[model samples]
Target: MSKLQKSAWFNLGLITISSLFALLCFTVAASKIEKGFNYINVILCLAMMCIIIPLTLIIAKKKSYEAGFDEREKIINQRATSLSLSGLIITLYFACFIPFVALGGGNIIKVVYLPVIFICTIFTYQLIKSIAIIVQCALEEQNG
Candidate 1:
């Protein structure tokens, strides 16, 4: 595999594992907390996600000619990014509007869930983009 492809795969694996581990930690901590959960604890449990920042930085530091991507990779990246951004837009619209619609119909949602929703949206976007990149690369390779 090319370096960029390898990096994409590595990142996908890292995110998947860290996300699962974070979920497990969150579940355990939530269960243990007889009282209402603490936001700080939730944030702490999610610290595993911070590794992605450094991982991305390391991957990005390796320079490739022309933004580290060829035309095909660039096109694939753009398409994947566009799709992911659309997903984020749809998610944000729903997240922002749903509460109002529910409230108008006389229902309320706890504000605590907002953080979780946002976090999940981000994770979902990352996963979707990575999968798209990998799939595009695989398809191109198969065709070639």
Candidate 2:
């Protein structure tokens, strides 16, 4: 796999694990404790940012920028980025509007959950971007 692919896979794995851990913590707190939302869930969710910081540093250290990318690679990356931006726009649109709609319908949501939604949006954006890159690579490989 290419360096970009490796980075994408690493990010995808990190996000998946972090998300599952947060979900597990939330589920346990809801099941074991009377309160559905608590500090534990918040802590776990926030900890994901911390965890990713180190992983990102490690990936950066391992990556060698000595070898430059070719025009084809640059084109693929540009296309993938554009696709990912479109996906993120859609994700953000729902993230902002859905909450307002729900709130207007008289549904009460905690402020803490808003952070989680934003975090999930970031996660979704990264995952989609990674997938787009991989898919573009595959298509290019198949065609040429």
Strongest candidate by TM-score: 2
Q: Give TM-scores for every candidate, taking all chains together and pairing residue i with residue i.
A: 0.68, 0.70
Error of 1 at 51 (Å): 5.2
In model 1, the worst 10-residue window by lDDT is 57-66
Candidate 2 colliding pairs: none
lDDT of each residue in 20-56, candidate 2, tens digit only = 6655554454453455666775575456556556645
List model 1 lDDT by residue over 30-128, tens digit each: 554546667756675556456445645644664453387878878887887888788878888888788778678577776546545655566676677
What's the C-alpha lDDT at position 121 in model 1?
68
lDDT, model 2, position 114 = 61
Q: List clashing residue pairs in candidate 1.
A: none
lDDT of each: 0.68, 0.68
